[model samples]
Target chain A: MAAGNRRVDVEEVNGVTVAKFTDKKILDEGNIQLIGNQLFSLVDEDRRMKIVLDFSNVEYLSSAALGKLITMDKKVKSINGKLRFCSIRSDILEVFKITRLDKLFTIKENQEQALDGI
Target chain B: MRTLPSSKVMSSSDDLTEEFEVLIPSDTTAGHEVQERIIGHLQTRNYHERDVFGVRLALEEALVNAIKHGNGMDPAKQVRIYCRVDSIKIRIEIEDQGPGFQIEDVPDPTADENLERPCGRGIMLMRAFMSLIEYNATGNCVILEKGRTIEEAEANDD
Candidate 1:
């Protein structure tokens, strides 16, 4: 049997790529590696740099996962690409605010807005 | 299941009578859920909202460092957290089984070029969240303290 809660799906929309994470724990290294590998592959493929990480599927994120996102953003920017986030829950948003990362990333209310922002 | 460093362990015989313990698997994803549980516990004890937030952030940072850096994603290593809460303050100690590194070697996240980078911010956040942050001589143990007093917390708020 599979772990129903520990899944992540990556897809493309309107030339913008979206990584929808559905893991019970978003902070662990295994899950981080999954997202990181996919994002890295996207960068390598010369796919759309405008990326949207849909957190609506994630209940919570650990600092490690946040670090992974920051690293991914930097990696994308190095290749003339950008990464944005959308559909974040309020509780997780508070984590962003507390870490002052809310000021650094371009966060949108939904995937369409995130895609539009780029 | 492994025992923590002697200095980091606070047995019931210690001066502090109140203690809290939580066992979390040494996986990255477990960090957030454990953090939420810890914050929920703190709230039940009437900890100030801001203080609760601070403790949660600090714990998240430390636990990530332990699980990711210390344990290196090895599930065999477990993060054992022990906290002591008193009327005046809260002290949290986290231990990991991985070989430790020097605290001074970590780069400052606020440094100009590093500001845009992601990995080093955990230590910076930990320092900002706790009033007193220190590592045991072996470096496998980390101790973080936040004040419970109104004045101290207010000072931290700024």
Candidate 2:
């Protein structure tokens, strides 16, 4: 996407890059695509090996959004990187559990927990 | 014996069903608009927060599948949506303009081997959130339903 339309707020905590989603819905197809690109850039362009996805601002997300996360996870792994998700709402957490993505990804209750071992 | 007015009778009935139909172009933007309309109706009916959340998510997936997969994002094509939000249940049917698909052919996204795949989770999420989901024989149209317990609906049931 464009530099003006940043989809994530990226910060660094102890060498671990934290990318927090800025959108609340994460439903728009264009938005999801941009998010996917932005996330991929973290692994491919920025060469950030350790990452955490903060979902505190996300109130809703669709399967397309989930698809982006799956791809993001794969990209991180391809680089021998670590990615964790933190502060997912109960509803979205149910989605992860239902899709069994909870088992595939490292999910923690809060940013503190997610950053602890990473 | 006197009977209530037709509208009054409807209000007194066990279910207050509201029907909606809209034809949207083969674009996901249209999908978001329709989703908001349906979600707004459910919110007005005072559906439980979780029920609203699930419906919103399922509706999003179904619309994306119709516009992106079924319609192939062809602007010349259109998607037809028929919905009924009753007192206790919501039924939505979405029809697309592309060749039909076979639901049976869709691999299980949650399968052990497919866990890493990114694309095939829409159908799985729909089934997870909604009470029922079925595709027509042609697979161009899919039906989604959810049975929710809204407080006002429960009072009406009694």
Candidate 3:
């Protein structure tokens, strides 16, 4: 199934295709892989290069999920595409900060900023 | 008869020790369920949401490490978890049926040289979220603890 049909909702904002994850809690391992594959499908299966992940709804995500974000970033970078994240809750933001992934990814405070930055 | 995965929530008569234990195959789905259950119990106990999230994050990372890195995702292997919560703090122990790793050898994830690498963040996140983290001599078992002062717990209770 497509990301839009699954845990994420896909749309275009300022010409950037954004996948807003609907899942509020993302700590589960299967949810991690499902979201990862959903994001991957956006690049590999759907051929959409530039994307932003709107994490406004996610309260918590596991490190494995964070690892998937890294993998997604690498995948998009390999194809000269872009991927950004926005609306990360403070709790989830702590994970990014602690792991120092905040330095590696383009993290925005909101969807508009993510679209503009990406 | 085949042994199935099992989980239990136990509270001693004094209510000082609330513990849960689960034994499951090295499957991500099963691991996910156990993690959720543990977190749910913590939330029900009125742990601060942020603290609950912190422990939840650390717990999931440890479970992932035990299931994926430790057990190599072998369904035949088992990952055992024990979580104990009290007014003062919560403690969790995770052990995997796999060859242990060297703790000192695990690289620092926040180091500049390893910043972009995705492999080492789990341990770092676990350390950051939990107050104390200990690895067994063999490295197959990890003990994670986060403390809330009695005052803090009572404050939350109020």
Lowest summed lDDT across 10 adjacent residues in model 3 chain B is found at B4-13
* Residue pairs in collision within model 1: A27-B28, A27-B29, A28-B28, A28-B29
Tens digit per residue, CA lDDT, model 2, A2-61: 667899999999999999999899999888888889999999999999999999999998
Candidate number with the higher TM-score (2 or 3)? 2
Q: What's the residue-level lDDT of A45 in candidate 2? A: 95
Those runs of model 2 whose alpha carbons end farther than 4 Å from true positions after fitting are: A1-3, B1-16, B150-158
CA shift at A62, candidate 1, in angstroms? 3.1
- The residue ranges of model 3 lying beyond 4 angstroms of the native Cα positions read A2-5, B1-13, B149-158
Cα distance off (Å), candidate 3, residue B23? 2.8
- Residue B11, candidate 3: how far off, in angstroms? 6.9
Highest TM-score model number:
2
Interface RMSD, model 3, angstroms: 1.5
lDDT of 1 by residue, A34-85 (tens): 7666666667775567778888877656667777777777778888887889
How well does candidate 3 match the true structure in TM-score terms? Answer: 0.85
Worst 10 residues of 1 chain A by lDDT: A1-10
